[model samples]
Structure formats: C-alpha cells, structure tokens
Target: MRIEHLAFNVTAPFEMADWYVAHLGMQIVKRGETGCFLSDKSGMLLELYEDAAAPALDGFSFPPATFHLAFAVDEVENLLRALVKGGGRQEGTLRTLPSGDRLAFVRDPWGFPLQLVSRAGATP
Candidate 1:
C-alpha cells in the first residue's frame, strides 16, 4: 500500500502546527485535543500530535542528518530565506548538484530538518 500520512510527536504541537501553516503553506484538515492534522499543497497529510508521557524528539540529540522531510520547491534560495525570516534556521550553504538540482537545508523553530529542493528536469 502507499503511504497516507506521517505522524510527528512534538512538545508544542499546536504552536508548531501554526508555524507550519504559516510558513509552509499547509492547510489544517482537522484538529483534536492532542494535536492537529495538516495537508500539504498536494494533499498529503501530516499528523502533528503531542504525547505528554513521551518526550518530544530533539533534532540535536537525534541528528537531522539521518532524517529530514524534503519538499519540492520552485525557488530554493527564496523559500529558504523566507523560512529563516519566519523563525526557521539555515543549516549550511546551498548547493547545486551535477544534475542541476538545487538544494538548501533548514530547520524549523523547534528544530525539525527540512530540505528545499528545486528539481532540474521531468519532476516539476
């Protein structure tokens, strides 16, 4: 079966959800006591929830290099800059792959890794 959604356990899910909606252009599909469900522009769902009994994962402790959510963007540098200006942090310098794809890395305010990529061909 194909994937329907992915879930994230966060400490401040409500505020985090707000940030995502504001900066990432996500829309709220539903809201619950623990958290909310968000949909990306293409309608993929992201479940952001809180579990008080479990500690939220810290990006530093978990190392974002091992995992990140990548988004296909039209302007990597522009969106990367906007994300940082909105509260995210830039990770490193942007790079252009030999295939001509452009990439930039950044982290949310709470420190979830996000990759902004502008594909070169056939996938935009």
Candidate 2:
C-alpha cells in the first residue's frame, strides 16, 4: 500500500496553510472548518490542522534533526533568501558536498525545519 498525506498538528491551521502556499509553492486542495489540505506541485499531500487533543510538533520539540520537509531547488542560495524574507529563519550554514549537491536549512514561522536541496546537475 502507498502512503497518503502527512499530517501536522499546528496552532493555526488556516494561517499556516496560507503561509505554506505563499512561501513553499503549495496549492490548497481543500480548506474547511476542520483543517486545510495542501498539495505540492507534484500532488504530494500535507494536512495542517489544529487538534486540542493531540500533541503539537513545533520546531522546539521536533528540532531540525528530527524531521524536516525537503524540496528540490534550482538555486539553494536564492530560495534560502526567499524563505527568510518570507518569514522563515536560517537554521544553519549552507553546505556544498563533494558531489556538488547544495543543501541549506531554514525554519518556517512556526519553527518547522525546511531543507532546500540542489543536486549537482540540478543547478547551473
């Protein structure tokens, strides 16, 4: 069986959903009183909602090493700058591997870590 959407318990589903759409290029599949479902350009699903009965997964508890949403980027530096300008915080220094892959980390407004990756040939 294949996995479906990944879900997150957030304080503000509506606002966080909007933020992801604005900054991460996600499209809202559906939004309702319960929560918001978002899809990447490729149609990978992510659900954001508030659940008073569930534990929250903010960056403080999860931390970058625990988990992060990664995305392929044409230019890590450029997208890194955009993420910060869009209210994300720089989590660490940019790194270029011997294989020529570029990697950068940042945290969203709610403190979720995001990894921007540029494979060796993915970027000029």
Tens digits of lDDT, candidate 1, 3-82: 89999898888898999899988889999999999998788899999997988767655555688888888899899989
TM-scores of the candidates in the order shown: 0.93, 0.92
Residue runs of model 2 more than 4 Å from their true location after superposition: none
Worst 10 residues of 1 by lDDT: 56-65
- Model 2 over residues 6-98: C-alpha lDDT tens digits? 998888888889998898889999997879999987778999988889877777666676799898888889889998998999987999999
Best by TM-score: 1
Query: What's every prediction's RMSD, in angstroms?
Result: 1.3, 1.8
Q: What is the lDDT of candidate 1?
A: 0.88
Deviation in Å, model 1, residue 124 alpha carbon? 4.5
